[model samples]
Target: MSTPSYHPAAVALQAVLALANETEREVADRLGLNLTDYRALSTLSQSGPMTVGNLAVKLGATAATTTAIVSRLQSRGYAERLRGEGDRRHVHVSATAAASRDIMNLMRPLMDATNRHLESLPAAQQDAVAGFLHTARHLMQNHLNTLSTKDTA
Candidate 1:
């Protein structure tokens, strides 16, 4: 009988996520942001305007939950929901200038510190590690697809 081949990619992805999430949670606590709000703000910060459905997908959350978060951000003047330029039925969310500045300020130190940690690794190692992580993310998408399919079943 042949034994199953061990998959290091999955292990590495999990380990990296665990470490990153732990560090991010600590930073988030200090920033006084809940994880969900942090993730939503991050999504908008990175991807620019997004529909609630898209934001939910980015945050791994439900549409209803995303709506609540969006509402809160709007009340805080951190984000605004606008009628889609092309389609009024579809709403798009955009971060206000203040929100953008806030997110950048909060993230700069974390990004800089993380970069410093990565700088200790050899250039070749950095590329190799990044390659592995890229592959891991692609592979993880398949896992997500499976879950979506299962939900339909």
Candidate 2:
């Protein structure tokens, strides 16, 4: 028999994920980078150097996947992995200057569009939207943490 139909919630979530990924991927493809690399570069641009494990967690990805992303970025000269001087095993990754500029340039249009759209909303509504996004992000993080814990148990 065919698989059962997904619930309404599942369908909505699938659509949201697909839409967001499709939009981001399209932009990234044009910029010669995948979503992972773009996200990693953006994160590094904001947060400076970070451990691979921390990067993986921040990216909501596995270490192996993040490692692959770091490897690709390294190969492209967009990022570098640096070992801490005092701690030999402490490895950190950061974006190259070129990568920082590229991400900002690539995201400029998206940022402008988002800002314009948000500006169209009433002031209170814009604040509400920002609050909602913050809460949504926290909720998603909690859900991911639960899933990860369950998966490895």
Candidate 3:
């Protein structure tokens, strides 16, 4: 019976995820949003306006679930559903200015600290770190896709 050892980078990634989860929870509480609603608002804030169907896809939620999330956000003044200009029938969900401002205000301190830390690293190191994060994000997305497929199956 031998113990298995994880790679240091993998352990560090886990730590990052744990901290990020905690941060998200705190932010959600402060914003008076549930985890899913905060996530939906964050996605809309970052990705701009998208249809409910598109948001559902992005959030890995069902259309009904996304609609409910949108409704909650609408009630909180964090999101709005806008009719398309060209196609009046097309509905798009967008994060309100208030949502954007609140999220940014909550996250700015962390972002600034992260930027400062990155700036202290050499350019080569910074690039390497960025590349590693990109790969990590891709791998996580693949895993998420696998899990979702398994759920469907």
RMSD of 2: 4.4
Over 3-55, each residue of candidate 1 has an lDDT whose tens digit, in order, gives 77668866676788898898667655754678778778767878899899999
lDDT accuracy of residue 102 in candidate 2: 78
Evaluation by lDDT, superior candidate among 1 and 2:
2
TM-score of each: 0.71, 0.70, 0.96
- Alpha-carbon lDDT, every model: 0.82, 0.86, 0.97
lDDT of 3 by residue, 1-153 (tens): 998899999999999999999999999999999999999999999999999999999998899999999999999899999998899999999999999999999999999999999999999999999999999999999998899899989
- In model 2, the worst 10-residue window by lDDT is 8-17
Query: Model 3: runs farther than 4 Å from truth?
Result: none
- Higher lDDT: candidate 2 or 3? 3
- Deviating ranges (above 4 Å) for candidate 2: 1-16, 59-68, 83-90
TM-score top scorer: 3
Clashing pairs in 3: none
The candidate 3 region of ten consecutive residues with least summed lDDT is 2-11
Which lDDT value does model 3 have at 14?
Answer: 97
How far is 23's C-alpha from truth in model 2 (Å)? 2.1
Mark the 10 consecutive residues where model 1 has the least summed lDDT.
23-32
* Candidate 3 Cα RMSD (Å): 1.0
